[model samples]
Every structure is written in C-alpha cells, then in structure tokens.
Target: MDEERPPVVLVPRGGAWGEAVAAAARQRGLDPVVVPLIADAPPEDPAALDAALARLAAGHEDSAEDADEDGVPDGRHGAPPTGRTRPDAAGPGAPWLVVTSATAVRVVAGRVPRLPAGVRVACVGAATARAARQAGWPVDLVPDDESAAGVAAALPSDAGPVLFPRSEIAATTLVDGLRARGIAVSEVVAYRTVGTGDEPVVLAPPPDAVLVTSGSVAQQVVRRMTPLDPRTHVACIGPSTADAARAAGLPVHVVARSRSAEALLDAVVETLHPNPRTGRSS
Candidate 1:
C-alpha cells in the first residue's frame, strides 16, 4: 500500500472563512492544515459605528411612516406599521451600504438587525455578498472584478451617500474613488485585523503551499514564518494580496482569478498541476 501523502495546503486564516477554504481543499483531494495568522476584533472605537446605525434606523422608521400615510402598502408586509424603514427620503436615493468583507456583514447585522427600507447593499466580492444574504440583508450589487475599485465602478454615478463599514486598515480605493465621483460617503471602521501571535507550527515536513488571504496576513506570515523554503508556494487570493506578498519579498506562485474560496483552491491546484495543452495553470 502507498504511504498517505502529508497535508499539501496550509490555510493561514480563521473563523468560518478559513473553514470554508479548508473544506474546499479537501474536496479537491488535498489535505489542508489551518493555522490562522490573524484574527478580527471589533473596532476600538465603536461609538461612530453605533451612531451611524442609529441614524440609519431612525431614517428608516420615518420613511416607513410616510409610505403608510400615502396609502402605499409595504412590499414585504402590507400593513400600517411596516416594521421597515422607507428608502425614498433617506437621500437622493437609497443610501448604498457597501460591505467589503464578511466581517463587515457580521458587524452591521449584529448592530442593526433590520436595515432601513430602500437601502442598497454593494459587496466587494461573491463571498461578501453571500455573507450579506445569509445575514438576511439584501445585496444589490456584486462587482465582477472582486476588488475595491470594482465596487465603486458598480455603483450608479448619481447614487446617494454610501455607508462603508470596513477594517481599520482598509485601503482608501473604494472610499476615495466614490468621493472623486461626487458621491458622499461615510466610512466607519467596523473591525480591526490583529495578529494572533499563534505562529504556524513547523511540521516534520513543511506544507507544500501556504495561503495568504490578506495583506495583514502576509505581514504576519513574514514576521512569524520568515525564511520560508524556496519550494513552498505562496498562493494569494487576489491581486492586492499578491502585491502585498511581493512587497514582503515572498515569492508568489499563483493568484486566484477571483477572491472566493473556490477560486483560491483552484489557483493552488493549477499551480501544482499545470495544464499540458496551454502550458498554464487554471
């Protein structure tokens, strides 16, 4: 009998997202070891976040009342107390709630269970959009590019104020891009990405590939697991993350076509198994 192969992939992430990646790896016939390099925590200052949620909730309530008085039946529930806010008076149009990560979805859903009626939600990628839908929040837009600029491009030019809940160290691409387009945006730090200090354990045989999901994770991988072996492939989730890996002097073997768990796994498999016909990995 052949000796069982050692785990081939190392997932340096945490929580549900990490689990999802590991599971996908298993489906692809690769054993995965999860060693989270970073953890997410609520923002140090949640006052601003709370205040913004409150304002949105209040605005929703006002709109719900107006809709009732005008004999307009609530679409979700046709009744006097719609139990939902109306979107028309919120701004020039429904305020766009842009969520860039699953963490943002958790933060917003936990704080405000019910969003104001007519609030449009734009997610950065398919993963973030799925999280929003799972949290019972309707998603209006998901960009094909799966990046900050993608979210901005997907939004309407005359869109109302955008509420962006993101990580503390999030890049200004989306926020800056929207503002340059003459759109008012209120950005709040919903969470902070902090190092867990739990370094990846050195196995008898090192993992064949190490997954880097974010720029922060890339920094931690460099700090904790420096001097990585040349053979160890560094697979990044997207271009931004690949740039971070390159900036840290880590060799990037592959980058996912999209910023989803499945895509990440596909990138890894393609790197390990190049297609003979095209001389390229999927």
Candidate 2:
C-alpha cells in the first residue's frame, strides 16, 4: 500500500505573496499549488494621486531637517510613507496614513520614502503590516479586526485627518466608516488590480481546498474554474472575500476570522485536516 498524499490547497496568487502562502501551506502539512490569476498595474490616471501627495509634501520649506529625536520620520518610519523622505512627516500637522494592501504600500513608498512629516500609519492586516515594515516605515496602528468596519472602529475617534491610498476598485467601507465617525479622510487611487489571464484556472491535480485572498480573486476563480469538486473546500480570507465568493456563485466552505494569511490557513487546517485525502488528482 502506498502512503497517501496530504491534502492539497490551490492558492490564486503570485509573487512574494504566493510564495509566502506556499510556505505556510507546507508548514501546515499540505501541498500548495500556486496559480497566478491576477496582476497589478499603475492607475491609468495618476493626476489625483499625484496632487494629493504633492499637498502632503507642501509646507515643508526645509527638507534638510533631520528625523525626530527618536529617529522616526515625521510620518513615522514604522508605518506608511507619503513618498520622498520629508521630515515634516512627523510634524504635528501631518495626517494619519492608512494603507490597506501591499500594492498600495509599494506605490506610496516609491514616491514618498517617508510620509510628509508628522503622519502616523495604519495597516489593514498582518500581511500589509509586514510590507510596511519591509519599506522601513513606522507603524502606529493595526486593528484587531482587519475588516473596514474593524479598522474604523479601532481608529482613534479623535484622529484629525487620514490619508488613504488604495486600489482603484477598492471598496469604500473604510472611507465610509471613518467619515461616519466624523473623521476627515482623503482617499486616492494608488494602483489598479488587473487580470493576468496567465492560465485559465486548470486543476491538473484536484485540490482539497482553495484559498481566496480577495474579492477580485474570488471573481476570477469562479470565472476561470467552475463546477468545483464537491469535496473541495473553498476558504476565503475574510468576511468580504467570503461574500464575494458566494455572490460569484462559488460555495464558500470556510471563512477566516481575520484577513491575514495565518487566519486563512487556520481555517483550512481546522476544517480540512480532520480527515486527510489521498491524492486528489483530477
């Protein structure tokens, strides 16, 4: 009798995020099959984004000023940047910068190495938080709840102003939630999420589970691959992704408690590991 293979998981992501997910799956004793279904592109029109960043860098007549006594930039290095290294980022008048995705982090950091002085930073989830740290930025806030409502509820009610750099098609939950709380929000499109069309979701070796990272991924998974195996569990990263999966007509088997990779895997392990499969080859 041959040894049975471990359960397999299909991850619809590429690049570093995909690699990380694969590693996580391996550690969890599952086989990870990666398929790059989506890609990122710069926004078609960057005028609004440029203007907002320009304003953020304004009032900084002296760019030679050093970082604060603690060595953190005005916007703070432990979070997100406004772009170029401007000490004013830590200044009292700075806005609180909010980054919801890793792509947004890369876009903003490329322009404003440091956010205009005095700007604080908030990340939506652990993955995004890691990206912020990788950019050499300071992080002041990371909500316990990774959802927009969670972020809004966790933010300081008295937060003066917030600078939100997000994807072109990003949902307005965060903006709406913050505005409803009486906080001023400046929203800008940082990038566009595009379809890769790399390969139309072919499952050579049928997976026991599929991990959906975002609403876009959910849509793509359903569009490219449908009539999934009844035994295949579709795990969504969070409530929003789960909703998207269901709306796209894909049955959602599990929903992670939060929007992080760890949470997603936790749901997978708890749901699928009880009874492992034996070589689910399509």
Candidate 3:
C-alpha cells in the first residue's frame, strides 16, 4: 500500500505564520497540525516604554540620531501622548505611516489616538497589515520583500514622510532605502525585545521541518530546543532568519525569498517535490 502523507506541523508562535502554513498545507492536500511553540505579548517593562514614547513624541535624542541606528526602544519614557506631541502636523493626517511588526501597530495605535485619517499605512506581512487594519489605519502597501528592504521597495510613490515605530533591533535598510527615495522617515522605538521565557520544548520525534522568522525566535529555539532532532530539516523565512538559524548550529534546508509564510511553504514544497518533470530529485 502507498504510504500515508506524513503529518505537517505548524509552529507559528504568534501572528500569522501558523495560519499561512496551515493554509498552504491544505492547498497541497497535506494534513496540518498547529503546534504553537511560543507566543508574543506586550513588553513587561511599562516604565521603559513610557520613556521611549516620550522621546519619540518630543523628537529629542541624547545622541546624534540617524535612521539606521534606530533599534528596538528600551522604552524609558511613558506611553505615547495624545495629540500635538506627534512630530509634524499633516492636517490631522499629514504623515504616512510605515510599520513592520504587529507590536509596532499596537504601539502606534495606543500612543497616537488621532492617527490622522489621511495618514496611510504600510507593513511587511499579512499579519502586520492585518494588525494595522485592526488599529483603524488604512493599509496602503504590503511588501513582497518581507524584509526592511522589501517594505521600502513596496512603498507607494505618493507616501509622504513615514513614521516608523518598531523594535530597537530593527534593520536600517528600510529607513535608508526610503531616505534614498527622498521620503522623510522617522525611526521610533516603540518597545524593546528581551528574551522573556526559557524552557526547551521537546517534540516527540522532531518535526518534518522547523520554520523560523526572527533572530530572537531562532535564539529562543536554540536555547530551548538545542539538541534538535537530527531528522528534522530547518527552513528559514529569509536571509536574515537563515543567518540566525546557521548561527544556532542548524542546517537550513530552504530560504524563502521573502520573510513571509507563503514563501516558506513554497520553499518546502520545492524541497520536497524535487523535479517531477526530470524524473529525478532537485
């Protein structure tokens, strides 16, 4: 008898990777099981975030500021103030907003109550885009790159100077790219990402493939699941993620073109299907 399809496991900790994986598996007639290994929450340190928001609102920087140097905020200030404190008045909607993460969406919404109706929004992935929509901002663009560079490339030509509230560890590529295109951009630290929990999650026999998107997620995975199953392959969502996976001592079987779950699934399918036309493996 022909063998049954092996169960495919989705390990999206939060946001939308798990759902994307499940959707892809279903499209391919594969049985998918969602096994969340981690989750995301607001930063535990409120005081730190409060301070960061204050700095962003005031446009005050102790050190010389550049977009590239903008990393995850330590949030030493208080919560984002309501009205006029926001940089530049775009007539209740002057600035276009570009956010790359789900957390950033929450930060922008909580801090800026009047997000200016004319301020359009753009993000890196479906999850971030969805988060923006939920925050009552109209999403203008969703990048195909999934990286900072991708988001930068996907920006609409008419998007005005953009306000980016993201992690302290965020890449400067987006900021630099936007600046090169003559788009004014602000890099604000909405929150900081520190390793929160620790405890290796051991699987029964290792999954067929493990998908990793962020450096922190990779670090956590390594710290938690170090003695990885020899048989399981690792698939990174993009170049950055692959770099992290390699650093963690895991061989990356595939690297998705963009940092999206759809790309990851495509990578997996290509790896598994090989070349049916050639009657040989890829």
Index of the highest-lDDT prediction: 1
Q: Any idea how many clashes model 3 has? A: 14
User: How many residue-pair clashes does candidate 2 contain?
Assistant: 32
48-125: candidate 2 lDDT, tens digit per residue? 888777755552322224345643335432233333333333433245778898888999988878775455788988
Error of 1 at 146 (Å): 1.1
Summarize candidate 3's per-residue lDDT along 192-259 as a digit string, tens digits.
66654676677664566677767766776677776777656677888977887788777788888766
> What does candidate 1's lDDT look like per residue over 177-197, in tens digits?
898877778888899999988
> What lDDT does candidate 1 reach at residue 137?
88
Error of 1 at 5 (Å): 1.1
Checking candidate 1 for backbone clashes, the offending pairs are 60-85, 85-117
- Rank the candidate models, highest TM-score first: 1, 2, 3
| Lowest lDDT block of 10, candidate 3 | 63-72
Off by over 4 Å in 1: 1-7, 59-92, 198-201, 274-282
TM-score of each: 0.83, 0.82, 0.65
> In model 2, where is the ten-residue run with the lowest total lDDT?
58-67
